[model samples]
Target chain A: MPHDHHDHPHALLPPEPALRVKALETILCDKGLIDPAALEEIIDTYQNKIGPQNGARVVAKAWMDPDFKRALLQDATEVVRDLGYYGRQGEHMVVVENTAEQHNMVVCTLCSCYPWPLLGIPPGWYKSDAYRARAVREPRKVLAEFGVTLPPDTSVRVWDSTAEVRYLVLPMRPEGTEGWTEDQLVALVSRDSMIGTGLALAAASVIEGVEASNQSVEGTAE
Target chain B: MSRVHDMGGRFGDGAVLPEPQDGPVFATEWHARALAVTLACGSLGQWNIDTSRHARERLSPKDYSRFSYYEKWISALADLLVETGVLTLEDLEQAAERAKDQAGGSEEIQKSHPLSSRRLLPEQVAAVLAKGGPADRQEGPVARFQPGQKVRTRRLSDSALVNGGHTRLPNYAAGAVGHIERYHGNHVLPDSAAHGLGEAPEPLYAVRFAASELWAHPEHPGDQVVLDLWQSYLLPEEVA
Candidate 1:
């Protein structure tokens, strides 16, 4: 009954968001319930140290090194951990490869259970209501939304991360990437490709992207 | 079965729009704090991930829709803390009240106490992050279903469906037929764990259901939905 005027019918609202979190963090820190520096460490870890690049490195190595690919496909968790790309939300890794015969995609319809250690935080689209609700039911339609259209004959397999096991889609290396170094192949791997919502960039597109950037640099110099 | 948060194939939410390439890990300060604090609090081991998830799942349907993603996380954090006796409502209220007028909280405020082993330290963060929480346990019961075996999802009784503790089984796949694609070994069953029934490790398998089996007159012809389902959620697909 703090505020209940006839004209203003709404209940009193809580403090602003930043203040609310600040209040919670303030209390928690005050009680030694949480370490402030640990909070900063987590933010830095996910924001900087971990991300799609780690996954790209894995995929690129798979594309270049057969033995590494075999290990990743066989025991992703140990293989990924050995490569130093293992952590929370990524404890149990199941990497499904995309092939000419079948395309693989990953989604968590009930909640956002993603591979945090490799892919960082999920992109908004992957976590969207549309993607979660429709991806399992109408995957091709969802893929079309992401601008990926597979041939009719190619089977599409969508992995729903319903348990502790997290999935990473090993998108097929695009054609014309022959004799490419692991570093060069890494440049072609998009985050969506690893999520199965999109395909890896074609070799031509990566070359074009490089050329386009160079052109921009030259234009700026002029 | 009709839980507000168990939205899998149900429609009318909206279209899936694309985010610009390489978005920020967190969009706001509150978001980062929400994520960090939730994880930090969970590190205290007061509750398991499933229990924390249940705290979020059992949120009022109205509030579930009203709250944003991180908002839900913060709300769940409060619920978890209060439910686990880590903090009182009065403590939360007093903190909010004291923070309302302040432009920004200062570091000088002292409520210093010795940190527990459960509390994550700054230096331990890296090793902790690298060494993630592994839910996989030693082999429990013998595996029932094997890879490539035809199986159908168990149709939970209406009571079990609505009991609503916490479950990894998505509503859309109930009673649907699929084939076991791979064996993921024994892992914690969230249904039991979330309700304090213990880890109750169970053999898990990736069951691949054709999208057509999940939906009628399917939108996509050959697409398949592979779900990591516990052995308990499955039954042998009896030959017709």
Candidate 2:
């Protein structure tokens, strides 16, 4: 079904942006500087193949295999590549694990640099001036705003991604999911959890989050 | 030059509103195209990612804040295209005029001009994604500091006077004392790479700075911030 602008009057983006993008694309394509098909391919890869699901798979696998987790912690790029998640913004990977005494959070204060291959695109908030500025100064307050309240004893270690190396947070595996399969465990890993803004969903709450996300998906699909 | 892009330890930007967990990859069609164009041009190897970021940062602060994320990309793309001689302003103007005419015409007008160049095929996309750009230099200057070594970030009295180039070091972290957490090996220094300078690869380290060191008041005294600092940005802590 084609998206009719008239039908969805409240579309967040106006028509001007689309027109401007089309103009730029036309110019670049006309000059033999870019191939429209190539552009589409890149977009499709990020939209479909590369996303939080890939990161979730890695997290779940790490939880199930101690050796893999060790490798991931020591050298993330090689381990992630072994699982076929390696590309731009993810070439130099660093996985910071969250423990009972210390929590890990990732932020790019300079720019919105994220692990694109593993986590697809960064969310809007991650790129916002608010998160970029306050994440370093008052991470506990920022995390609390994301509904990620930590215990007073557990110190927050904010990883400011200031260089080429990309950082990913390895949230501790939730309790009571000891026997869960990798696939089931993947369902508990949300994008925010990996960013350290939120915690991994517990086994019981995973269903509710999944259902809520499904509803949001349906809403956007229309 | 203490650009707005170096936004660490600053305050009062507003609340980070949470979007739906499952949101569209792109908010609009143009955003996808903008991203594609940027990546497509990027694959040409004409410029590195650091250069592209510097192009965006070169924009005036007002223009930088006014444009949406992808708009910044498009603006930088245009500048890069012109600067690299890939496209001319006249060519873009003509194309814009043609696009305007096509928008008013029938669908056939849009289908008339087909892309002629070799498109980045699906197979090529896979290869490109697989062959990531690792900035680490195989052999370079040996690392100066080891883990657990105390260090302080070099403070530039006037950042504008520091070669007038973009730097990865945040203003907030400058002059702050920290402990070297790990040596991340040699990587291209972005301060040089962003300005068409040769890849002066240097050893980088993950430096751990206490929250109290960076801020006056403490939200959590136990908190700490770790930054990946390039070799050029650091100096050995002065002995008493």
Q: Best candidate, DockQ-wise?
A: 1
Candidate 1: interface RMSD in Å?
4.1
Window of ten residues with lowest summed lDDT in model 1 chain B: B156-165
Clashing residue pairs in candidate 2 (N, C-alpha, C atoms within 3 angstroms): none
In angstroms, what RMSD does candidate 2 have relative to the true structure?
6.6
Tens-place lDDT digits, model 1, residues B1-240: 568778888788777997766788788777888788888887788888888788777777776777777767777777677667777666676676667757544545446544355789989889877877899889688799878889999786122433756888888898889999999889988888888888889999989998889888676677788999988888899767
Q: What are the per-residue Cα lDDT tens digits for candidate 2 across B1-240?
A: 377677787877877887776899887777888888788777666788888988887666765777778877877776776676665566555655666687644223223223324335545776786677889997768999989999999886123323657788888888899999989999998877777777889999999999999899968989999999888788999657
RMSD of 1: 3.8
- Measured by TM-score, the strongest candidate is 1
DockQ of 2: 0.39
Model 1: per-residue lDDT, tens digit, A1-222?
454312111111253556657778877887888999999999998888889999999999999989999999999999999988888899999899999889998989888889998899888777667788888877887888888899878998888898989999999988999999988899999999999998999999988899999999999999
Candidate 1 CAPRI grade: medium
* Model 2 chain A worst lDDT window (10 residues): A5-14
Error of 1 at A221 (Å): 7.7
